[model samples]
Target: VVKWNIDKAVKGDPDYIVDRINVHYNIGHLQAVGGDSTRPAGDYLLALNKLSKDQYLPVGPDLPENQEIIDISGEQMKMLASFPTPPEPHDAT
Candidate 1:
């Protein structure tokens, strides 16, 4: 027997929801209901960003402190200081 609850549960996730909405809207369904235009654009975008959490956050300014780290160590530091050539890449033949 087909299990409707299981099927519905899988289809109801956030990724599934976003994908379905995008597919419908993008494929000539300009007047699709309950999508971006129906909701306040700014509010909907903000909610989507919050809902997506790890995926949609802006890259640079507001990223968590630990995420954007420019580690200057070893050869990187030497090169920046104009010290000398670092090391040539290994030729794997």
Candidate 2:
């Protein structure tokens, strides 16, 4: 996850990048609490990664879906925890 400070963004700011935290394999979708609504909560974020990539083998299969909880309350994004999610047959780009 890359936390950006867009409030102070200017032309020379270089994408307003504040910090970054790596997830397991491939990050697919990201959902912050209330992020899709008018009242977006900025405290935490839920990251959906497409592949676990052996990070969680006990969960089984070649690769499993993963969800990671990240703390975004501060200037940098921090990885708090991660868990395997049930596979979704449908794929949405």
- Indicate which candidate wins on lDDT: 2
My TM-score estimates for the predictions, one after another, are 0.13, 0.76
> lDDT for every model?
0.21, 0.74
Tens-place lDDT per residue, model 1, 1-93, is 011234556777533221111110111112112334455322111011111223334555553111111112221211111011112211111
Off by over 4 Å in 2: 10-12, 58-63, 89-93
Error of 1 at 76 (Å): 56
Q: What TM-score does structure 2 among the candidates reach?
A: 0.76
Q: Write the residue-wise lDDT of candidate 2 on 1-93 in tens digits.
A: 778777658556666888888877677887888887898878888888875666666655556678888999987778898877766423221
Q: Which ten-residue region of model 2 has the weakest summed lDDT?
A: 84-93
- Model 2, residue 75: displacement in angstroms? 2.0
Question: What lDDT, from 0 to 1, does candidate 1 have?
Answer: 0.21
Consecutive 10-residue window with the lowest summed lDDT within model 1 = 77-86
